[model samples]
Target: MPRIKSPALLVAESGADREGHGLRRSMGLFQLICFGVGAIVGTGIFVGLSDSVAQAGPAVVVSFVLAAITCVFTAFAFAELGGAIPVSGSSYSFAYAGLGETTAFLVGWCLLLEYGVSVSAVAVGWSQYVNELLDSLLGVQLPAALSASPGDGGAVNLPAVLVIAMAAALLVRGVRESARATAAMAVLKLAILVAFCAIGLSAFRDGNLMPFAPAGIAGIGAGTTAAFFSYIGFDAITTAGEEARNPRRDIPVAILVCIGVVTVLYCAVALAAIGAIGGDAVGGQPAALSYVVDEVTGSGVGGGIVAFGAVVAIASVVLAVMYGQSRILMSMSRDGLIPGVFEKVSPRTATPVAGTLIIAVVFAVPAAFSSLDAVVNLCTIGTLAVMAAVNVAVIALRRREPELPRTFRVPLYPVLPLLGVGCCLYLMYETGWTTWLQFAAFLAAGLLVYLGYGRRRSRLARVTPDADATDAVPQPV
Candidate 1:
């Protein structure tokens, strides 16, 4: 058998320019870390916490730890591959270079679900917080007609749609500008969370943790899986590899540092909310922290502050996740796996204008009328599948490219990657049958698209006969 050449080794020679796309190398470690933290911190901490606590009681803090562990394992793997490949579109680019065209297509398809659906979900959540803030602070409420989905007793989600549109506009302006905006939002949200923790902790009550694991191990496991959704965007750090000032060193640091900061924030907030409002109550309602603070303070100030924080946090998530989606589409287009129009960059802004517009429309429509739960569930399943793929890819790359330069490596190699795979799969099983079905349907749709259009147009499929003859080995499984 001839040796199969990994595309991972095919470095685009330094200074080799691709046409049409003029994205500059402008991101630094701080910006990359902010992107990851901004995207990861939002919906999870703001909206999903109540759901997780409802499932696991006060033990939801433990769920955070478990979820962080799972994320750390995957992050290490991502750091290694991201450093080595240093490309946009993250796992899509990694799979294309390490695996083959078919696997790469599948990964890209999964990423569409991860970034696109996640952004829409976050937008929906942002709308909820926006309404809450308005009602609490301004003595005005968005009319029901514009506050929620029709199915949820409202005609449309105006806030969600607006936020999605705003994010798209920001992305169209330029990557650096968008990154700066995300960083600012992230800082503001983090500060508010710290303030919440400080005030809530001062009023802590010990009795709230009486039945810490009330739903038992099964519930704890389910909560752990749900909590993992909050950690999805940390990999966004890896997606900026191509633009990072020093990807080999900065990418890994950004991922690990962001994860550390986020984990600490999550644990503190969970503790504060539970301590201040009795675990029972916090676990039983929407906007858990807000409700808890209101009860503890006998006033709405704390609740209003949390609601405001959530608005900013969820908005940041929408911007970051949508940015990730557009970049992935741009990468697939450049690889010839999708239509070339997506790869077209604006000469003025150096952004993928066409791709951004398409993503904006797709996200905005759903955000305008769909439930956040549905979109969040879909994103969780897709992200788990992609994380599993990255885990396997990491181990394969290690064995195949033993000499590859890695700025960061999973310390225990196969052990860590295998653990990451197991954790992601366990979470996938917990995401419920309905979500699994949707994921299966999405994969089937991707298969049809690949067969009907991608197969012929794929850059890999068009490899020259001479090149094929020289490297005529069965592609990696």
Candidate 2:
């Protein structure tokens, strides 16, 4: 049996051993902020907005607010934990420090769903925009047989597969290069969104906001469950802790800044779209934002512009989310909870080449055949569970290790963590029983992996009684 890893040992492994593994600290605050924005602003804003509106009517704005509030609480918790631990595993690392290896493995398992499934979901959404862009610009469209996901009326989505492969190629180059690419794409996406809001606002009709809470507070709760997915990737900032130029100082700032910037952008875009064309026009549409642009501009030009932006946005998201996933696998491998191959960082590129390729294949195969809705639901449910664990981890750490050095601490302590936990559970309840069944099945598979492999191979089990291994490693503070 393996002994549980202590918090101090976790911190040591994150800083020194992580460097020994070849991860370069090349990302700065700006790059990290870009990563978060790239991940958080993609498919949810461009494609899922329609579903959100259909669920909550005009009051979807309040839903966005509620979701933002929920994320803000968790973001603070992530900032504190990431600063203290400064590890690549995000909430998974935090759980190991505050809870134990068993809990950490479970959180890591959930995050596998959050980041991996999210990459696939965004890829599927990207396929829709690519097909739409072709139809708008060249008056040509891929045949339905080739463009749609299986059982969604098509054989396979080639575009989705291509995009995932492309993102994986870029990631293999190096973290710095990937960060620069993500930053550029994020800026382009933000510019397109701002343009849409500016032009669409001119068509605003106050009447569109009437009966805002059409379905009442219950609708707001449902809307929040969906909108919460929009804020999913802000925590990706914390995953870059080991890669950040100044992990303790920069990671916290980047997390909070990313959430603040994206929250404002989401609310503004939602308001502009609904106020201009009304909720009914946007609901259940595949290209809701582009549709609003076309409606307001009275031509396909605006739609074409939005379609191009959506391509950039969705690809950026896949890049950021995939980057985080590979790093998490790397961390888990370092703990001996998975095969060490995932922990292998290339000497020249300093990136996890083997892990990135593996993730790309996994993401592309399912993305080519499954409907986006099922994977998106899995991402949402998995994320809420991971976040709720993180919130509890923060409280547990505070009580268990008050003397530990922390660069950022959650304000109001127990209050915020409690609220975050409550909010996360409430949203999980709102996601419907079908999603719960899917998440349970997913967790069962993770348990099999843990029981079959992780439990026996964990590094803690290899240490002898007379020799203390971690004593040789310098502690990070």
Candidate 3:
């Protein structure tokens, strides 16, 4: 049987002086905000907007609002837990402290699917835009054999492989240096979006929005499900707890602020896209924003600019997601749930070199040869389940350990968390039965790993002299 680890140990693992084994606390509030923004504004918006518009017509605006509301509730739960735990595992660490080791490992496993597949999906999107940008500017494009996935008529996606490798190399350098690169990319993408919105708003025609909500309330729900992916990356902020200068205060601030910024930006861009080209065209075009710019201006220059921005946006998202995955693995390794090598930190860079390399390779292959839709479906299913569990963990901790100091607290008590769980479950249901079956298969595999290996190796199973009484629950181990 697996045992539960105390919240104290989780917090200490992050902040304790490890004689050069700990991650560097170098990120400030600004870098953290940039990191969250970099993660949040990605292919989900650049490529997903058209899908949402197709589902809800011009009513995609309502879908964005509904999705943001759900995320806000979930974000509140994350903020409270992050402030209290201040650990790198994000939801998994919180689950370990409040639930048990079995549950924590499951969350970690789901997160692996979420982050890994998200990186792959973004990489594929990046390749498409890079091809578009090159064709627009130089009258040249990579051969289909090198630019597309196996099923998409190409043997390998060279651009996708190249971008993932670049992100991996940058992460190996150091967290601060990586953060600077992400922040710069974040600023560039934001500026491009602003320029898009300005040009698009000028072409707004009220007639385009006439058939809003064309598919009825059902369409609205479908649209919400589509737009929700844009909000998925905000949780990556909490995974940087060990690297934050003031994790308790900074993580919560960055999460909420980034969500707010991205929500407004998403709506602005969505509105512009619909207004400039109407719902029919947006629904059909994969590169909706670029197409809108070209249509409204009657010149490919505007489309070229949006294509460049898409490249920057997707690259930054891949960087942030990869960073988050490594940290989560390192946290699990520290608890003895996985191989100890993942927990190894580089003395010079204060980063997990081995874990980063493993994640890069795992995602790079899929990005090069797999279908983007399959990756997106897997990412969505895993992310929804983990987020729902996090909401439950927040409520459990509040009831079980009210004395724990929380720099940030979720307002409205149990209401927000309960609502968050419901929204997450609804989204999961909307993902269809096939996805649920896939998720079940993934969870079953995770349970096998936990029972066969994680249960026996968990550090919390042994009651050391320094271990807390609460952590020493006697079990079959």
Candidate 4:
């Protein structure tokens, strides 16, 4: 029989307080919400809005709503599972408890694509805004060779790699400091976006919204596909399962609150940008938020402010997402799925120091050379796959451990979970054919690694009654 970890054991481990054995529980409800908001509002809002606008025109607002339906359905499942499991492994832990070991490994492998590549991609986006900010302020910016990726007509992207390294340094310093920075940056980001909307609406021309669907339903569908990935950020909150104070309560509420906050920001920003400058100008513009601000004010002051905001905002995404990625690997390491180095938490900092540096170097190299639009679809495909597994795990756990202590439950029972899975599949189908092939290669690579390394080394390989003994975990108050 395949090994399925017990949810009871998972919860027991999360609540354990052995010296130097677990992550520091420093985040509360507020920080968790800020982390989610910080992660979601980055590259997707600051950079990709133009491409989405080009696709859906003024109708991009509709696309945001359509895309949010997927997140709405998935959030309920995540909230429920996050409350019940509350492990640093996030969905991977949920799967390990609800599904078999092989399946859990696959879910984790897919997450590398989600959190890992997404941060690199966000870093690349940050480079564009960095130049915008510098040029607006000092009339100078880094050259293409230093700022642009090789695929984008440059030799290497130094800025991208540097940003990732900086984020790693902050993560290594400690999660508490990282959360504090994220919360502050989250407030700054919201303020800039709200300011952009207000300024843009002041210059709003009703005629700019003419021909709302230039590309028709097909265009709207394409835009919806682009917008859907923006919602992937909230799951970063789930990865904090080990570091959250009163996680069972805070984690679930954080997911819900993050989604609500992000959805409003996305729709409002998209609408405001399109309203001020018209879809034609907004479409295909890099440094779009800055561009929109410049057009409205006819001065660099507003543009510079928005650019500065984008710089800080995107860095926070890099910080929060990289933190989540490091934690995931650390959890996998504890299970003997990856190198033991990942499991080594520094007693001084209470953070996975070595694992974080490795992640930074591995991801930053690709950030120096990879194309922006190329791997985004790869990240989306990977994220959708993991979410589908999470929805399934929720159902599996309910049937297998009906009495498990859960602070929250998915309404409509299995129907909501099933819809969540369906939404994931539908969105996955929207990506290009290359994304499917790439995901297949990643899946196969994961299987080989598991069979050759993880399976033999996994702590569960020799599970015994005494080894697994732990008292039932009580639901958080």
Q: TM-score, each model?
A: 0.94, 0.96, 0.96, 0.96
What digit string (tens of lDDT, one per residue) describes model 4 on residues 1-477? 667778777766544323345588899999999999988888888888998998999999988998887887888888998888788888788888777788999999999999888888899999999999999999999999888877799989988999899999999999999999999999999999999989988988888998999999989988998987777678889889888888889988999998888888889888789889899999999889899999899999899999999999899999989988888888788888888999888989999999999999999988999875777888898899888898998898899788878899999999988998998888788887888998899899999999999988887765642232222344333
Error of 2 at 441 (Å): 2.9
Clash pairs (backbone) in predicted model 1: none
What lDDT would each prediction earn against the true structure?
Answer: 0.81, 0.87, 0.87, 0.86
Candidate 4's displacement at residue 372, Å, is 3.7
Residue pair clashes in candidate 4:
none
Between candidates 2 and 4, which one is better according to lDDT? Answer: 2
Worst ten-residue run, lDDT, model 4?
464-473
Give the per-residue lDDT of model 3 (tens digit) for 166-252: 999999999999999999999999999999999999999989887988999999898988888878889999998878888889989
lDDT of 1 by residue, 203-280 (tens): 898987778899999989988988888887888787676666788889889989999999999999999989887777
At residue 351, candidate 4 shows an lDDT of: 91
**Compared to the true structure, candidate 3 yields what TM-score?**
0.96
* Residue 79 CA displacement from its true place in model 2, Å: 0.6
Give the lowest summed-lDDT range of ten residues in model 3: 468-477
User: In model 3, what is the error at residue 161, expressed in angstroms?
Assistant: 0.9
